[model samples]
Target: MGVVLAGGAGSRVGGADKGLLPLNGRPLVEHVVARLRPQCDRLLIVANRGLDDYADHAPAVHDETEGHAGPLAGLVAAFGFLACNRQALPRWLLTVPVDCPDPPRDLALRLHAALAADATACCAFARRTGKPQPLFAMYRVDDDPVEWRASARDALHEHGSAWRWHAALEAIGVGFDAPGDAFHNLNTPSDVDEYERAHAAS
Candidate 1:
């Protein structure tokens, strides 16, 4: 299953929903779904507001955790949703932030391949320019149900970020050297300006 994590409140962008922001005359969520659709058998979105709008692109989901627990909390909800929906669950869950409009074409393929080849790894993420992009990754299903949920809850309370959870899973990081910087995201106003300027120049 492919999950586009749009549950964030986009606090850094002045509390506006990042996925609904305009990019090239279309909602950014639309752009993200377009790119990820081809990579998975099923596409689902995770958004906190404007559920109907997001559902127009793909089925939308919500984070079960309280108090804006962030992306890790969103993933926990996604996993729980999948747990109840056994028939639609995929062996691996591919997640990308809704704000990233230009992910690499082979993003899912690379992460899936990396996790498959590594026996001990439960997650495989993108690493580029010597930096790790953990959220844009593929996670293999945890066979142990009880521990999985607990681990997620613990991570949400403890680190407040996905980094610790990624480490706990023994994740594998796949490297990329593409010049296009496919993982570029519109997380802030400056990012939007930089991307627009770059696009206009090109």
Candidate 2:
């Protein structure tokens, strides 16, 4: 299953819903969905607001915790949605933040391979130029999701950092040879404008 983490507070982006913000004439989440769809069997979007808008792209699920807890909460929400719907747990849960308009095209393939090769790794995340990106990760889902969900919730309650939680999971980092700007995040309005201008010019 593929999940888009769009439930951020957007504190740096003038409180705007970054996922719903326009980039290249389309919502940021739309661009992410288009890139992730073909890589997975099913897609889900985790958003705190604009559910209807996000739903237009894929089945949108709200965060389990309120007040934009963070991406860890979004992970919990994804697991909860699957449990609530009685859906079979996918072998791997692939996730990417919505603000990252362009992620590695072979994200899932590389992460899956890394996890498959490492018997001790509970998950695998992308690392660009030695910088770990926990948001763009693939979590191994065991036969029962209870343990995984519990650990995620614990991490969410203790510390809201995705990297911290991923560390506890012994996640492997799969390096990508993509450009340094491949995972450029649109955190502020200026970032969005700059990206638009750069891409439009190219």
Candidate with best lDDT:
2
Estimate, for each residue in 1-202, the C-alpha lDDT of model 2 and write its tens digit. 8999999999998898999999999999999999898899999999899999999999997888879898999988887776666556687899999999888889999999998998788899999889998999998886656777778889999998889987877788888889755788889999999999998898
lDDT by residue (25-85, candidate 1, tens digit) is 7888999899888998898887778889889999988787665668887787787777777
User: Candidate 1, 188: how far from true, in Å?
Assistant: 2.1
Question: Please, what is the whole-model Cα lDDT of each candidate in the order they appear?
Answer: 0.82, 0.88
TM-score, every prediction:
0.92, 0.96
What RMSD, rounded to one decimal, does every model reach? Answer: 1.8, 1.1
> What is the clash count for each candidate, in the order shown?
0, 0
Model 2 clash tally?
0
Native-referenced Cα lDDT, model 1: 0.82
User: Which residue segments of model 2 deviate by more than 4 Å?
Assistant: none
